[model samples]
Target chain A: MSSSKLHPLYKQLLRAFTSRPSDLKTSGRLLAELKVVLIETGLIFPQTDYSTQDLVIAREILEIGAFWSIRTKAMPSFDRYFSQLQTFYNDYSSILPHSEREFPIRGLNLIRLLIQNRIADFHTTLESLPLPADELIANPFIRHPVNLERWLMEGSYSKVWNAREEAPAEEYKFFVDSLMGTIRNEIASCEEAAYESLPLKDAATLLFFRSQSEVLDFAKQRGWLIDLTRGVITFTQKGEEKLEIPKEKLIANNLAYARELEQIV
Target chain B: MADVEMKDAKSKSDAKDDIATPPLSPVSEIKSNVTLIERAVSTLEPRFTIRVLRSLTALRKRLDDKALCDAISEIYPQDSQVRSSLLSWLPASPTQDESMEVDPSPSPKTPSETVPETEIYFRLLILHHLLASPSTYSEAINLANETVQKIQSLNRRSLDPIAARVWFALERAYELGGELSDARHLFLAAQRTASLRHDDETQASLINRLLRSYLHYSLYDQADKLISKTNFPTSAPNSQYARYHYYLGRIKAVQLDYTAAHTNLQQAIRRAPAPKLAPGFYQAVHKLFVVVELLMGDIPERSLFRHPVLEKALRGYFDIVKGELPVSYSVRTGSLSQFQTTLSAHAVSFESDRTYSLVARLRQNVIKTGIRRLSLSYSRISLRDICVKLHLDSEEDAEYIVGKAIRDGVIEGRIVHEKGWMECGGQKTGYGPEVSEMFSRRIGYCLELHNQSVKAMRYPLNAHRKDIVDAEGAREREKELAKGIQKGEIDEEDAMGGDF
Candidate 1:
């Protein structure tokens, strides 16, 4: 209702929430413009006397900014917006959007931390939730991150990857995809070390790539040689010398496995 | 008319014979002598009254104030003409100058100066004054100080009884004015003098009074030290013993020793003066008893709520605990918010009665109850379900509560961390050590109840009236039988057939 009388910068920033940024360039441009307007109003410095509507609008813009940073895989930018949202919630929660909007972003923020392998920070974030885990998980937004964390801890890569499709909000999908990407790379590295080579089709599925071209690009980055006629990718030796494996560790692993087998009996 | 005349003649001759014969012990001698004064005062003869009053005045210097007051009160009640003459020695109300004139040595004298009989009577009067009109507390304290000064100046070793009583009055004044520290300080000083004189009654009563002050101010360490350092009397006046147990109960309750606290509180309730005589002390002990029972994780007996005196005070807790919207319902149904509201409603009353700590434990009780119900409903419930049911924040918190419950023997279960499940061991059965211990405690309680009832029973010849002793015994037996059936020690069908 007060849309017409809002500051010009506030109006422009409001666009971020109304429409999703089409590409990284547009998102980056909109974020830069937001930063300039926020600085000019001294809002970045926490200027006083902003109306409740203004604070609400500012919180919405920051929420979108957080999603953009996650989508672009920029963690520091995401942290900045998330912390600002936290301040807004702490100070102006009465005027800001409902908890429904806030919890999903927090959930996505947790996914980003998981993807970045910040286990300690992930737990710290989970600990900060005011709601109990049971009540918290009842909300789809909050449950998405919690389930992701549990699945990741279980080392269930497939479950973590499948979780992307079930994200509660559109912005959550960005971080879920990022988490899957990290899981895929982790599996790729383990596969490379465990085996000399694998067929292209197996490699594509293992890497969670829908097409061979994506897997091919990834293989190039890992310095693997592809034989299109043979339908196989070959691992290249790094140096002109033989690499020795640690026999002690292999024996330790075997001993542990044997103890576990004895326990099963 | 002839029979009444003969009965009066026989009573008078018996009284004369009792006095003519000296008693075996000094206690019996004094008892018979006091009764002689009572008989003489009833004749309304001026000569007999004067003779008895003079003898009592001489004996007052040697006897305890309590016995002197009791004997003299027979001739002169507080408002009598003789009592007014005794009051001429008190420093208040323009009597100080006249009393000073009688002290021929106007200048300060040492212990040898005549220890007036009226000085002991003055302290007695001051104690009565303080007890009746609380506004005179400061004035009473000032008078006590002056008397202590005079007694110390007299410097007589045998006047310790007089000094002890003066300090007792001072302590009562300090306690009345809410100056607990001063009261305790006076108690220590008086105890030293009373003990040195080997005055057992005064010292025992003083310790009982001091323990109550310690409890009121929550000076638990001081109370514990006094109990340990002092040689308690094997027997004392019933009122003093009752107070001793009541304060001991409060101290133990503060220390969270509910078992010992329960024993002491029950004793206090039993030994307390009748409700008509000291309702305040009687009701206070009863309230604390209820709290101790609750802390022990056992519901108070329903009969406790039926007392005309205790019903009004205990109704709130009874309603929240056993009435509609019971705390158990909240826990079993996961209605934490409702439980919280109920607790807060009674918080003020609980704080005033000093049962706030025990009542605050209700939250943990509710949570444990929720976990136990969950265990019964599902053999293996995920930590998430426990969290939901207990309104806990996380699986880790639920795990911690469940782990504590298992350790405390409130529940039997193992937590599987990897699977995040609490695998309940179902309900433990068989005559294990825990069951045997429980059985022993129940038997101990039943025996204690039986012993108390026996001690509490009235004469069998008077059994025509409503016998509280019989009723309490029947109630306890019913409770024991019900518990036996619940524990499966007695089959219900067998109980019915056996009864039939």
Candidate 2:
């Protein structure tokens, strides 16, 4: 109950957690120190000999680690802490009140899985959850990746496109944006098979690009001949120009086929 | 035994006073509780600290917020003994209720310690509650101003976290109390604190709030400047990141970056908190998204309108697109005045929400639809014919609109400006465009994949240690070469590119 009675490093870890330095470098150094303290004290890693207070401090450290890693966009770092926290939560959840951060973290994990295109892992992860998928779906965080995977598999490109605005979590957008990149390519192929060339503005709209500049960048990346000053994209003007088929041979073949049909009749 | 004797002695000294202080009023209750806690704090067990703070906060709820703030301020400096006692418990009590006052305890036992950072955090929380719901705007502004002065007086104790939280709360209060410029200045100061700490997440959250404040004040240039200077955190908490995207989306929409705007809005919507948590924010984003989609000339799916939460908000926009009203394409081109009148009636509600741009885009949507129909109905049409059919102001205007539609790929055609006719380019022999576009996009993707693999080789985490080993090896090699040269055994004919 006293500072002296607690783990020597507990006070230090608490200070870092509660008044985290604003500077990234100092914050990073503090996090590294916390990890070392946790490891040295056997609060993390294998031994389970911990007091209720020690466990509480360890959980606090892990939670903040997860938050900081995610904030820095360090997914691998975040992944380690989140898994540690997940195990901790499963073992000690009954002793503590539900953390508001739990569902959001779970939701973020689902999105990370979706982004990496690990659908199998995503399903397996969801299946192993304590709650039913139906109940999880009630949360916007869980619903987003689940719904996106469904729409993607179903070939509902529009639905996937529509999801851009309905993503349940912020990090979900990072995945959704990537998913859209894939969807756009698919749609572009379909449109190419069906039409000669769409208008420049129409192409931009159809491709879900929000600006002419973006469309032009994409067009350039695609090696399309775009006359931006005139607002027209000529999609078929590169190496295939020399591969045109002979028009006379096609007509003669058609005439011969008609004559052969007449003789058979 | 020492702890017990100290506790008894303190209780006996305060027992008569506690008995004298009646609990008839909430203020009296809080006062007595504070005194009792102060008296017992030095000898009190660390585990009981949170319980005491919770009781103080409970008493806080019953007292008039403004009166309680006044009372706390009055008692705060006068009771230095209690303040220092509370401070003694501070280092060991990070989990203490953040609303309770915990001063920098001048306990002789820990005299050399830096002020616990939580002291500033708790103080900021107190100031936030005071400014958050003051009975009047003047009271809120006055409280904010006073807190700013108080915080400045603690300049010597200004650590990064303390500075960041204090500035954030003060600026927030300023913004709420309708002082935009002052809020902007403090926001910049808070931003500096976050930046100095290299706290990307805090910086992004601050930027989002600042942008919202900027939007509210219509300070477009300032918002643009801030966004250009700030780097949005790619890996922040989804809620804060979602807000960043949402605010960015609104700014893009205003700037006519409809493409970027739609992307940001989509991210905003995707990352937006679920309906139960922040329904209003979700609904607002959805409304903007729908409007942006419409402006881009895409018909939103029927299912999108089926969401019960968004149905009511998007109904009017839905009706216009779905043709629940009798507005026809012919009417859109034939009578601009009549169309404007009808459109204004349907779009009036959006005006209040500053969606004038999207509402105005309705005409463009109508014109685009009319031109698409014409291309299907006829092979070629004179510019004059289009003007008459669509009821435009002049041939030039019609030509400009048609030309824009053509460039946008709404209609496949060439405008013969001299002949004053639009020649529709039919979809024949167009495989080359699609095939090439697809090929190029694939090629581009492959290049990016290659680049990413090359970049992944630069992992700083492991690279630093590796670099040290490499440096040590190079130093050893140089030492051996120097020894060889000293013995005159090195060949002068060695290759020029060899390691020195």
Across B9-53, the per-residue lDDT of candidate 2 in tens digits comes to 644644544465454454455455444444334433222333434
Per-model lDDT: 0.62, 0.60
Candidate 1: CAPRI quality band: incorrect
lDDT of 1 by residue, B1-500 (tens): 76567546645654565476544222344445444434443443323323433343333333332333444344344434334434433333432233233332233321332224333434544454444345456766666666665654565433433444565566677767677566666667767776786766567777876777766655565677788899766444466678888888877776557799899999888888678667788788888887677666666778878888878888767755663234344444436666566666876787677666456545555565656667777888888887776667666446545655665556666665546677887564564545545654675566566656666655543565567787888999989999999999999999999889
- What TM-score does the first chain of candidate 1 have? 0.67
After the best TM-score superposition of candidate 1, give how far the Cα of residue B403 lies from its true spot, in angstroms: 0.9
lDDT per residue, candidate 1, A19-126, as tens digits? 644556665786787776666665654557776666766677777788778777788988899888877765455555665568878887777777787764665455
Evaluate candidate 2 by giving its C-alpha RMSD to the native, one decimal: 29.5
TM-score to native of every candidate shown: 0.44, 0.43
TM-score of chain B of each: 0.61, 0.59
* Full-model lDDT, candidate 1: 0.62
* Regions of model 2 farther than 4 Å from truth: A1-265, B1-117, B136-171, B323-339, B346-348, B376-378, B381-385, B393-400, B407-410, B416-421, B428-500
TM-score of 1: 0.44
